[model samples]
Target: RGFFTSNRDGGQGYDDIYKFLETKRLLCEQELYGEITDLETSALLPDAKVSLFDSRFNLVSVTNSDEKGNYSFNVECGKTYNVRAEKIEYTTKEQKVTVDDKRGKTHLPIALEKSTCKVAIGDDLGKCFGIKMIYFDLDKYDIRREAAFDLEKILDVLSQNPTMKLDIRSHTDSRQTFKYNEILSEKRAKSTINWLIKNGVDPSRLTGRGYGETQLVNQCADGVKCSEEEHQLNRRSEFIITGL
Candidate 1:
């Protein structure tokens, strides 16, 4: 067996080691090879990250797709692995693989779909796709199921780009006192950050803020008569990418 180190700058400025071994053929061992491609057009995605995890969720190995979007891994007989492919602005693709008790190489192809949320740097709070103004119940700071579902997309973007940082901001309508709204919106923002942290996002990459009816989308301000729909628009949450 021999170890080869390459200065493959997979965007992280780090070295990666590749192992090579020469051995006799065994009936119970095999290797897995595959490529990552776009699910819609079937075009290859370069620099996509491929990760192999064991049954207990321990990370076994990680590699970046080459220019051709190709990746590979070696395995033993009957061992199970969860293979996940991730890329920025794309929905993660996952598959379960188990090597059969036969010799030879196995092929496992992965396809990732473009994410509905096209999150980009310098994008305004609600400008991105799949990101809408999150509304909350009256005076409530807890996260709703619908809000949680939408937040997952933002989480995916943050997870794939580890160096990215965001500020989770919350707002409220003029129905409540200014001070009260401010405090409530702050809690709401904290709640959003907490949910993301609980779902495996790093806390260092996130911050919470409450604008408290300060940045109204329209003229629905205090002493102004507005429809319920207009008021709902003011009570919202947003995610802003603060750093790269």
Candidate 2:
């Protein structure tokens, strides 16, 4: 018999408990059991929500961790599950777990780490230390919405360090003419640099360069058919901390 248990309170919460059990009964019809734990300093986090999603990243079920930071849910076997944890003042963590027919239960432990660096800004910003590789879509100079979040992080770092200089370099997949890609990549790099300048980052501290298809991170050579993801890797914008 499968059941739900928590150490927070006794029988007073039976109403919610019964409802949860009924949902679990329905879930058990097509799902296996999953146990999750937070391994951060052994501190219990009550009411932390745990959601399980399938291979396509669609939510399958949801549960909450007890005061002891423990959560369990019934999930389908032979499916990939993406587990996500959320809490205030702590960065969200995600992990992909696969369940197989041979296993009746899955135990997963997650650790949440803290961010230590101060935000960068203004004249002191030129001293920012971290350089991140930003990715882009095929032949597109415009930054993707997903890339904006990362750029914001970089902006925060720059805001904290006022005297830093960053060189923005753009690259493209080896599918186009060298001259064409070189010109397009340079334009892309400049576009990104312009975006930073417009967003409060100092213009003098930034430079842009286009490397075209000259820098290949993978083996897919020019004129060869490759996966979109592979080609996407070639189309990237990266930052280098050249001066501080």
Summed backbone clashes in each candidate are 0, 26
> Highest lDDT among the candidates is held by which one?
1
Worst 10 residues of 1 by lDDT: 124-133
Q: Which 10-residue window in model 2 sums to the lowest lDDT? A: 120-129
Compute each candidate's TM-score over C-alphas: 0.54, 0.51
- The per-model lDDT (C-alpha) reads 0.80, 0.68
In angstroms, give how far residue 118 of model 2 lies from its true place.
Answer: 13
- Provide the clash count, candidate 2: 26
CA lDDT for candidate 1: 0.80
